[model samples]
Target: MHKSFSLQMGDKTLELGPKPLVMGILNATPDSFSDGGDHNHVADAVAQATRMVEAGADIIDVGGESTRPGANEVGAQVELDRVMPVLDALQEAKIGKPVSIDTYKAVVGHQAIQAGATIINDVWGFQRDPELADVAAHYNTPSILMHWDPNRDTSKDIVSEMKRYFNKSVQIAEDAGLIKGQILLDPGFGFGKNYEENFTLLNRIDEICALGYPVLVGFSRKSSLGKLLGVEPKERVAATGATTLLAYTKGAHIFRVHDVRENYDALQVAHATIYGPPPAKDI
Candidate 1:
C-alpha cells in the first residue's frame, strides 16, 4: 500500500505515517445505534472525549445525528445545537487533537468548521448532497467519503459499486476544488451491506486500499458483528477489536471505533507483528 497521506482542517493537520490511526467515535446524539445518548450533554461529551484521547485516540469524531436503522432524522439546527457545545468545549479544553465533524449537510459542516472541526466525514460519500463536496472544498478540510445509500441495491457486487462510488466521489471533490490527497475513502461497514458482504469488503479492503487512497473502516459495534456473533452492539467490542486487527493488516489507514483503548491496543500488537514496533507515544 502507498504510505504518504496528509489532511488539513481548521488549524489541524493529520498525516498518516506508518501505523494506522485510531479515530475515537464521539456521538453527541440521543439515538446513535451504539453509545447513543451517552455523550449528549457538554460535560458528558467532554468527559468521554477526554477519556478517548487519554485512551489513545488520534482524532475525535463528533456526530449530532444518529443514522441508526429506524431512527428519526434531526434538523440542521438541532444537529448544530447538539454538536457545537461539545466541539466548543473540546476546543476550550485544548485537547490538541483534530476534530472531525460527522455530517452531510453543508450548513452543519460549515458551522462545525467554524467551531474548530478539521475533517468532514460524510457517510453518504457525497452521493446525498453534492453540495457537501463544495463545503469541504470551501473550508479546505479533509473529507472522508463513506459508502452508503439508504436504498442501495444489493443485486450488484458491493465492492465494485463502492469503487465506482469512490471514483465518482473523487471526481466531485476535484471538481469542487479539493485535491486528491485531501480525500479519504471508507467502505462503511454495516451501513448498507449484508452479513456476507461486510466480510467480503473486509477481506478485500487491501484491494480498495491499493486503489491509491487512504482507507478508513468503521466496524465498531456494527450490526454485522452482531449478525455474526449473535451479540448486541455493546457486546461487540471484542469482535470490533478483531475486525480492527484484520482491517489494519489489510492496509486500512484509519479505524473509527467506540472503544479507543482496545482498538489502539489491538493495532499496537498488529503493528508489532506485521509492520514493526510503533513508538511508545503512538500506542
Candidate 2:
C-alpha cells in the first residue's frame, strides 16, 4: 500500500494518500508537446483550471514553458510574462485547489510563489538552478523534484541511477531548509528516458516508492504511449488511464495528467477495488 501525506500549501492542504491525487496540467505555452496553444490566454487558462477542478482535480499545475525535447528555451522574462498573468487570474478566481508552478528556473519559481502558486514542480530536480530549492524552502512550499538527465547513460541500470539522482536532489532540498514532508519525487516517465527505459522505470517504480517520498508519475499523452499504441497525442487518453492504474498499483501517490476526469474515474475504480468503496457522503 502507498503512504499518505498532508501537503500544507498556505491555507490549503492536499491530502495525498492511498487513493492517489490527480494534478491537472495547465500549460500556458504555445508549444507544449500536447495541449499547447489551447490555454495561452489568462481567461482561457482560468476556465480550463476551473473545469479540471470541477472534473475532480486535486491540484492544478501551471506551466509557462514547454519542456518537450528540442523545444527552444525561452528567457526568464518571456516565461514570466506568460505565467504571471495566469497565476494572478487563478488566484483571483479562488479555484479552491492548490496551484503548482511547473518551472525549473529559480526566478520563475520564486515569482510564481509570490504570485500565489503553492507548489514548485522543478522538472530539473533542483539540479538546474541551485536557487530554485532555496525559493521553495523560503516559502515552505511542497516541491516536486523530477528526475531529468538528458545525458543519462542508458546501458546502466536506470532505477539505480534514478535513486542516486533523487538522493542528490533530497540532499539539495535539505540543504536549502526544506523538510522531508515538503519534498516529493517524480521519476519523470518521459523526460530523458528512451522508450524501453520508460517501461523499465515503470516496472521497477516500487523501488522508487521505497525511498519513502510520495512519487508523482506523469504519462499523459506521452510519445511513449503513442509509440506503443500508434495513436496521436489527443487519442492516447485510454493509454494514459492504463498507466494511471498500473502506476497506482505500484504505489505511486500522485498522477500528473491532462485528462482529469478520465484519469480520476480510473483511480476511483482502482481505489474501490483495492481499498473498498469510501464511506458515502450525505446530500
Candidate 3:
C-alpha cells in the first residue's frame, strides 16, 4: 500500500518494498548479544561497519546500547559517549552508505543526527520518551517506528495490541510534522512479546505492512528463534537467514541483521524466486 517507496540519504536513494534491503547491524555496546564489546572502540566500529558494507549491506545500523531483554538502561550521556565518536569516525572516513543510529533517547537521537546519522532506529517505537518524536521531527530524520507494547509484565493479545500500538505511534509521528517518506515501520519482534506472539506476528506480517509504510523485520538471533529452533544464539545464523527470506516473501522492505552476507545471499535467492532472474548486464 505504500505504492513503492525509497529512502534518500545523501546522494543515494535506496529502493524498498518491491524487494528486500539488508540493514547490517553494528553494535558498539560492550554487551551486545552478538559481537559485543568487540567493536566498542571507534577504530573497531569503523572496521566492522566497513566489513558490513563490503558484505553488501544496504544500510549500516549502529547501536551503542544493548537492547537485549532485561538489559539495564544506560544514561543519555553514556549512550552519547558510546556512539558519537564512532559516528564521527564513520563520517570522517567517508563511509558511502547511510548510517542509522539505534537508540531510544531523545538527546542521543538529536546528537546522532548531528553526527551524520540519517536514520533513527528507535527500539521503544517512540513510546519511551515523548521528546523522542520531537527530536526526530526536529531533525526530519527517517525513523523506523517499531511495534512495542509499553504494557510491562503483561502478555495479552500481543499481536493485536502491537498493531494498535504501531497505529497510534504512526499517527503521533504524522502529527509531529514528520513526512510519510520519513517514516518506516518495524514490528519489534522480541521487544515485549512471548515466542508465540512473535511467530503470530511473523506469520501475519502483511497486516503490518499494509499500514502504507516501508516494513523493517528484525529477528536476528533473537530468543524467539532460539526457542522455536531449540538452538543457542551462536547457532541462529541459518534460522536467521530463513527468517529474512520469509520476511522478503511477506513484503518486508528492510532486514536488520548481524550476518550481512548470509542475509544478502538469502535475499538474492528470494528475489530471484519472486521475480525471475535479473536482467543481463553488459560486463
- Per-model RMSD to reference: 2.0, 1.5, 2.2
State, as a TM-score between 0 and 1, how close model 2 is to the true structure.
Answer: 0.97
lDDT of 2 by residue, 1-283 (tens): 9888888888777787787799999999999998989999999999999999999998999999999988999999999999999999998999998889999999999999999999999999999997999998899999999999878777789998898899999999999999999899999988999898888888888999999899999999999999998999999999999999999999999999999999999999999999999888799
In order of TM-score, best first, we have 2, 1, 3
Q: Write the per-residue lDDT of candidate 3 for residues 119-185, one digit (tens) a residue.
A: 9998878877757788888877789988776564354566567767877887777788777788898
lDDT of 1 at 109: 90
List the candidate 1 regions with Cα displacement exceeding 4 Å: 10-12, 278-283
After superposition, the stretches of candidate 3 with alpha carbons farther than 4 Å from their true spots are 1-3, 10-12, 150-156, 279-283
Candidate 3 clashing pairs?
Answer: none
Candidate 3 has its poorest 10 consecutive residues by lDDT at: 150-159
Candidate 1 root-mean-square deviation in Å: 2.0
In model 1, pairs of residues that clash are: 9-118
Candidate 3: lDDT of 170?
75
Top-scoring candidate (lDDT): 2
Better of 1 and 2 by TM-score: 2
lDDT of 1 at 168: 86
Q: What is residue 195's positional error in candidate 2, in angstroms?
A: 0.7
Candidates' C-alpha lDDT: 0.88, 0.93, 0.84
lDDT of 1 by residue, 1-283 (tens): 4376877655556888567799999999988998888889999999999999999999999999998888998889999999999999999998878899999898999898889988999988887788889989998889999888656567888877788878888898899998887999999888877889999989998888888888898999999899888998999999999999888877888999999999999888887877667466744
TM-score versus the correct structure, for each prediction: 0.95, 0.97, 0.93
The candidate that achieves the highest TM-score relative to the unseen native structure: 2
Clashing pairs in 2: none
